[model samples]
Target: SAKRSVVSVSALAVGDKLPSDIKLSYFDVEGNMQETTVGSLTKGKKVVFVVVPGAFTPTCSLKHVPGFIDNADKLKAKGVDTIGCVSVNDAFVMDAWAKQLGADGKILMLADGSGTFTKAVGAELDLSDKGLGQRSRVYSMLVEDGVVKVVNNG
Candidate 1:
């Protein structure tokens, strides 16, 4: 049998509207499962969505998240409304990771447990061969009023 792969799609870029159907589930600081849609989160604000493969991973733990955490205030002062960290992990894991990284209040920890949101954004990375299921690619985007304005990826 031929190996199956996720369908390739054009990555989201500046001027594209975030898919309204992409709903992300997250746990509040108090550990409550809360549901939010992409439109609800970025509807009328300047949001920075920092997407990582997983929570607690080395690079994401040591670098990607830290950069956002440390520069959160600066970004806010410059007019950013929110900085959200998203991963293909469950709400419990995401909440725990947020506390572990001291990002509970500094950043919005969003759990895309289903990877639906990730795929909708054209950033899903397949890692099933490595024992990990479909996950999000590491990337960040600046969204304003639900429209992408900037994208950064390594």
Candidate 2:
């Protein structure tokens, strides 16, 4: 169950760079918090950012994140510097969800609470009808040295 969407409007392109002003920090498995600034995370690197609508949901918990988790090694082998998972959830929930799905080893889960980063990247999807408020759409972005190369979204 993969969600797909055509690039409508100016959602994202194959050669856009990630905005460097925003910094993100989220909780870890041990309840300790770790904050990651864009400068430190994306400096001179290619990063893959995957977004999910919600955490612990049916499609997400069962398929979406796991798909990336399973394929992370292959992606890395292809020269990806880091793989990140983004969601509308807060740090604690994101932290726990990552561990539960065994994604901690394969991906870095970032909490996009307040949809700050979501709206910033133009990746926010309206799921109010589905009881999901201001959640991120199911999508993935390939970034080269911090510049966006391609964005696939639903």
Candidate 3:
């Protein structure tokens, strides 16, 4: 059933360029909300962008996010410019979650509060039945210069 749900949601594919005008929010180290675009973050860089269903959720907190946090150094050694964790949550919640998980400076916590980028990439997961409303499907992508090089939807 989970696999079926994932299959039903269309996701970004390899070789696909990230959509423009996609806005994402995040909190800086100073605790200030900053708005950024997908292009700006991925332009001319090798980014490992991971999307989770929600911030602070059990799976994301205990496993998905931790995997990246634990492997941050190794991933960077391999030339990953940035490791970003995106979720359908507000910037404040994302920031708090990052702090709780000790992800500061290790992983960039990106907030897709409006689900704009998720929808643009066709990875929007409808979890209304579970009372989570619209969220992102669990997925990761290797983005190089704004073009998707690899995609893994779990």
Candidate 4:
């Protein structure tokens, strides 16, 4: 059975500060593990975050990510300082997926491997019946200076 997401889409309104305690990891250009906080990423900067169900899911691969990649320039033109594609996958998978999509400079591939960030943001979607474990719901958000400016949940 498909279950509704745990995240209260209505509650994450504009001006709400996203949980900063969640730790996210990713592979740097040197392929070494790098750790960062949501606060570090959004503090004093305009950021567009595209959260996905998984790294290589069909809809995410065919449409969601492509949409961001294609419109990255426009988003940046409109003052989006950073565009991130986050998923509950490990850093290696995120890095490889980014490369596969040719997203080198177009999008920042963020890894929330432990689902800590996803759960912290109230976006955790349980799919354990399918053996996939917890994942993030598909959504987009605009954050600035550590506060949410806009949230579009799908």
**In order, what is each prediction's RMSD in angstroms?**
5.9, 3.9, 3.1, 4.3
Best by TM-score: 3
TM-score of each: 0.90, 0.87, 0.93, 0.89
Clashing pairs in 4: none
Model 1 worst lDDT run, 10 consecutive residues: 4-13
Model 4 C-alpha lDDT versus the unseen true structure: 0.87
Candidate closer to the true structure by lDDT (higher is better), 2 or 3 = 3
The sequence of per-residue lDDT tens digits that candidate 2 reaches over residues 2-81 is 99855552366787777776767676656688877655778888898888888898898998889899999999999998
Q: Lowest-scoring 10 consecutive residues by lDDT in candidate 4?
A: 4-13
lDDT tens readout by residue for model 4, 1-154: 9997765543467888988767787777767778888889888899999999899888899999999999999999999999999999998899999888888788889999888878777778888988889888888999998899889887
Give per-residue lDDT, candidate 2, residue 72: 94
Better of 3 and 4 by lDDT: 3
* Clashes in predicted model 1: 0
Per residue, candidate 1 scores C-alpha lDDT tens digits across 1-154 of: 9997653333887899999767787777677889899989998899999999999999899999999999999999999998999999988898889989999778999989988888887887898997888999888889999999998874
Order of models, best lDDT first: 3, 1, 4, 2
TM-score of 3: 0.93
Angstrom error of the Cα, residue 11, model 4: value is 5.0
On TM-score, who's better, 3 or 4? 3
